[model samples]
Target: MSLRNITEHTIALKDFQVQGDAIKTHPLSIGASTNRTVNGQQNPVIHIRPGETQLWRLANIGANIYYKLHLPGTRFHVIAQDGVPVGRAYAEDTLLIPAAARFDVLVQGGAPGTTRLETLPYNTGPAGNQFPRADLATVVTSGTPVTRAALPTDLGPYENLSHATIADRKIVVFTENKAGTIFYINGRTYDSSRTDFVSTLGTVEEWTVRNDSDEDHSFHLHTNHFQLMSTNGKAHDPTHGVYDTVNVPKRGAIVVRIHFRDFTGRTVYHCHILNHEDMGMMAVLDIVPPGARPRATHSG
Candidate 1:
């Protein structure tokens, strides 16, 4: 019961909206307004002071939707991810925010119930190709709204297992074929592997993602960032702190953990919506620095 690192007042998400998109029935907008903006907008509530430790700075200013923030019973710790700050941290019931990213969660607010902030669209596809994009729930109580009835069907529980010993791991494979695409992370579409993983510097990678098509694809990566020890298989308390876009909970299999030191060149980990990464999804990485093996670009 000794968790100190308290910093108060920090919860800002000004006007965000994104209501469901299949053909429109609940596709509110304004997660940053769109042009192609990758679906973003679910629940955005703020208010803390039950035990202190609230320091949030989330702003996906672009909207690509795929957040799974929680606080129901309270168990938070995700030091930093798109904002940097993690020497070796863990813990995540659900934390992923892509699209111009930005995260810094650490809620330890003691008992008081009500704490839900959901957003879905991991990689919507299958189910006959798509249709059923409707998930936007938000509740950060202090007064009203905290009556548990629905919103915890499953997919919640990864409090750190053992930091899956890593030497090197990367496999992000998400697909969505046809023509009118909307999601696809690893299947070679977005400008051809955008930058196709290339780490080395101080290597310490781990990304075992496989959302096999049928919707739910939020595999984001940019400038080598990781800290989501586990999900799907369970485990999230290695200090559940440090994240960068981890909402891959449908087919489920999220394992993020990196330490490539200060970025290198070409940094962009797509699938944040914007026309499904310009109609193909996206991928690109090159933090090279070990046994250099560059030169592997494809296009056919």
Candidate 2:
């Protein structure tokens, strides 16, 4: 994987509308719509010159599906995970679309055959979850709805390359019981908790993501990227190497290394399922400047 010819592109969210009516019954679901454009459209398409090494900044805005971002006929050398650039390479097919997760995928464009950006359901399906009245349920215990299409892309500006060391890390614990199980980070629920992990800006931290749910959950962060250190207590693939969004299988843990840089505000980390997130599967991280008065940290 090389970066000699990678050009940047922006992925906007557009052509989207509220999905199901059944969504209304759910406490935190995105209510019904005739043709609602929820997240933005106009996702950036990366065009890599043949045999060129280019860098791309990939971002997501609220679309809650997992995207298998790839350049068919071409392979990408991962230069960065999330927002922090790395010195290694990793080949990937499915890029997790966790609200604000970012990745720097280096690729040389393929043979010009409609490179498809696919979004597949992380779990089994969304078919039976809908009530007769058309309200969308947060959990799809039955099957996937055929109407679902490609997930949206949310891209943002790239700040100066980020680099920091791990000051702290923790596992986002997601435990729930329902027709569709929701998630929680560190046993704290989303929206209700507001803040989950707090870090000092300019500091690096390693987060170990543990997924103890019956279904898969895509854990995403707001302002940073992480290196694929280990999964299930083993080292992640370093050749087809590194990624920003990772799919944590049921009953496993993926360890990620990240650095906090640039923006410092109330950033979010959550499950990409927009409904799940809105229903309480999300958390916030605060990036405070170093040597400043420290806030009380929580670990449970």
Candidate 3:
């Protein structure tokens, strides 16, 4: 299942301005798709036998919205995130997914009845928009009851970067103008001609990402995944696994350690919110070969 925002009238991101950290046009509706139908138009259903388990891949593919998904009387056994398998499956009653995030979960069918998978109201912050509750899909279990399947064990191993030798550390800050028309990272707008950060391949580096603005920002990096070390000065369970995107709360900070593995090239790190990205909350990163000097470019 994927969730997205739908406006009453189509509006381009370039034309949609921000005021006080809120968009000029709030989404008229939040659309959910099991396959093709939107807003449960056809009442899309997931048919399963009672007590049987099925794997469900849920994703937040929207540009700027967040989904706090909930299925009453059901617990989601999360096994993976962003397509990467976790160290072990963990149960969650609600999932708070920001834009571009994905969660793969195992769901066991309940009694022979129908239930709605819905998103609960989520308030990003004082400066952000409040998203209301919306139903995403209908899950129907009608077949004869079956033996409950056991949740999977032996999920692949995950790397823990807590004690890794960090080659370097960087600080990334998210900020925005008072009017909220423009956004920034590290105090500057994105300049395509400039390279903001450079790192050597095969090195592990830690980054402290701070959100200075009044709203939340989903920090996302390209080319490699990162292990979240801590958020708001609180340590995170390394066993939760790595992710390509994470939420940076308003005026709070998160520390992530990343291993610059195999691929070497230029990529970007930015706010996953498309509007903020389009408004300039992004930076360029270049991974050069070890012992090689980085190419000259305008500094951000």
Give the best candidate by TM-score. Answer: 3
TM for every model, in the order presented, reads: 0.31, 0.57, 0.86
Give candidate 1 regions above 4 Å deviation: 1-63, 66-219, 226-268, 278-281, 286-292
Model 3, span 1-300: residue lDDT tens: 211221121101111234466654553222222122223233356676788777777777667787787888899888888879988778999988888888888777788899987778877777677767766667788888877777875587889999999999999999999877789999999998899999999999999999999988899999899999999999987878599999999999999999999888889999998878988999999999999898899864
Give the lDDT of residue 238 in candidate 1.
Answer: 50
Q: What's the C-alpha lDDT at position 4 in model 1?
A: 40
User: Candidate 2 at 189: error in angstroms?
Assistant: 1.9
Please state the error at residue 29 of candidate 2 in Å.
6.9
Evaluated at residue 30, the lDDT of candidate 2 is: 31
lDDT digits (tens) for residues 1-300 of candidate 2: 322333464453222343364423334333223221213333333333333334556565544433444333555455566555554345666555444456666544433334444343334223212211111111111222122212112223332212434477676675555555444666667653345667777766778788777656677666666566777888754432345566666777887776675767668877765676665678877777777664554443
Lowest lDDT 10-residue stretch of candidate 2: 131-140
All models: lDDT? 0.54, 0.52, 0.79
Off by over 4 Å in 2: 1-8, 11-15, 18-58, 93-99, 106-169, 191-205, 223-225, 237-245, 258-268, 284-300
TM-score of model 3 (CA atoms): 0.86
Give the distance in Å from residue 257's predicted Cα in candidate 2 to where it truly belongs: 3.8
Clashes of each: 31, 44, 0
